[model samples]
Target: MLVAFSLAPSGAPTDSVHDAVAAAVRVVRESGLPNHTDSMFTTIEGDWDEVFAVVKAAADAVGAFGSRVSLVLKADIRPGYSGELTAKLDRLEAAMEQSDDPA
Candidate 1:
């Protein structure tokens, strides 16, 4: 399973949430799970229980920054498939490359 999530804190002292976001991301990085972080979301690949645990821990870490935390999550649950993180992007790139070639 691949879970992509974003976490934010509300009622924070400052308008910038970077510090809170960094806290959440640190939890993800230390989990030893296959993960990727971009400008918007952090995606983790692992079994359901393990993955959600990390997500929960990350959200909890964000809670310290403000009165409340909000999380947005999306999941791709494919039982037999693994490594879709890079593989999906690889396939998309291959398709785009093929489209550019003249027959």
Candidate 2:
């Protein structure tokens, strides 16, 4: 999947934005989703489910700074018909669900 997200804090200082963005990206990537970030945006590619989950994690990381945060996310679930790519992500979700199941 391909995604573009933008974040701007409501009461955050400009100097802190870069660091905040970087930190958020780090958190998302740590979630097992690959992340690519530039000055003001982060692009993440991964399983459809994990993509959403990673964005949520990134938002949490941003919130950790105690600054009002905002985010925009875009994703493409139809990258290709080839099973090689999509299967990997599907497997990831299956693993996550298995790990999360309580019963």
Number of the top-ranking candidate, with TM-score as the measure: 1
Query: How far is 78's C-alpha from truth in model 1 (Å)?
Result: 0.5
In candidate 2, what are the lDDT values of residues 1-69, reduced to their tens digit?
756687655566554566667778787668765566776677777667777777777787777665677
| Tens-digit lDDT track of model 1 for 17-93 | 99999999999999999999999999999999999999999999999999999999999999988899999999999
lDDT of 2 at 37: 74
RMSD of each: 0.7, 12.5
Shift in Å, residue 18, candidate 2 = 2.3
lDDT of every model, 2 decimals = 0.97, 0.69
Give the clashing residue pairs of candidate 1, or none.
none
How well does model 1 score by local distance difference test?
0.97
